[model samples]
Target: MDHRDMRISDAERERVVAQLNTAVAEGRLTIAEFEDRVDGVLRARTFGEIEPYVTDLPVQQVKPPEESELRSRSSSLKRRGRWTVPRRLTIVTLSSSVKLDFTEAIFGAAVVDVVLDAHSSSVELVLPAGAVADVDSIYTHASTVKSRIEPSGGGVQFRISGEVSTSSVKLRYQRRFWRWRW
Candidate 1:
């Protein structure tokens, strides 16, 4: 039997689903078409059966940035608009303000790991819809980490682990409407 005739595993199926997600995000497939293809992928029993679902799609061979670091002292740092998010990010600040807006950013990986080392600073992350963050593993000293979004494990996962001294870390969803500030 050929390799295509071999049986497929669940992990392989999930990888295809991830590819389908990327395709949809990149506007290569419509929502309805994605739904149909996902249904077919679920019903597929062999490699040959799943080949047609993505054979026409371009292979995503572009490697995302490995890691990113943002450091500041007595200054403010902000990231907004369309940008490629790396898998790992480190932020170190002292007496500064850092804001990361991910509403229009591209997620390179499903899981993003953030390491924070801050002192007397404020860190704010404005995430998109369906994105969740976990700040349970962070160590704080006279610092407060607040988040309105709960980590339910459905969409993109942000594993935040770090230490904050006299700092503040807040995670919130993007606002749909504009709010005027006086």
Candidate 2:
């Protein structure tokens, strides 16, 4: 028979032989069983002939209707203005330490400002005054930063910091669950 007409690549046959040898070495199959399986793989005339050996493994399939419906609904909410994109700006500092200053007017109504200080060895976050004003409760999820909402004269400050090479900051609107990160 022509080598090409056999419909089995040399690499594929070698891989099956290796697997059969390993199975016998591991005592999962007797020498007779291993030889039979290896021969079958080598003699496979079409891809279908190898199906029985691979059927037990999981295979990928298209998503079902119920899953597709849920995905469509979730995407529709984003287009309906339920989520707002927060403004993000990146600033580079050359000084050993830097301080950022801002006021409520810098951010429009219901918008919060987030400042990320990215230094060579440290990172810091500063939240605007109105970020969480309307919320009845406040909880922090990240352990890196020591968060504090303190009355500074007539305004409030939310600050967090840690040792970091680069700083990323996000402005979050609690009620809308909208965020802008930089």
lDDT of 2 by residue, 112-154 (tens): 3233333331223334444332222222233133334333333
Best by lDDT: 1
Tell me the spans in candidate 1 whose CA falls farther than 4 Å from its real position: 1-60, 178-182
Screening candidate 1 with a backbone cut-off below 3 angstroms (N, C-alpha, C), the clashing residue pairs are none
Q: lDDT for model 2, on a 0 to 1 scale?
A: 0.38
Residue pairs in clash, model 2? none
**Highest-scoring model, TM-score:** 1
Q: How many backbone clashes does candidate 1 have?
A: 0
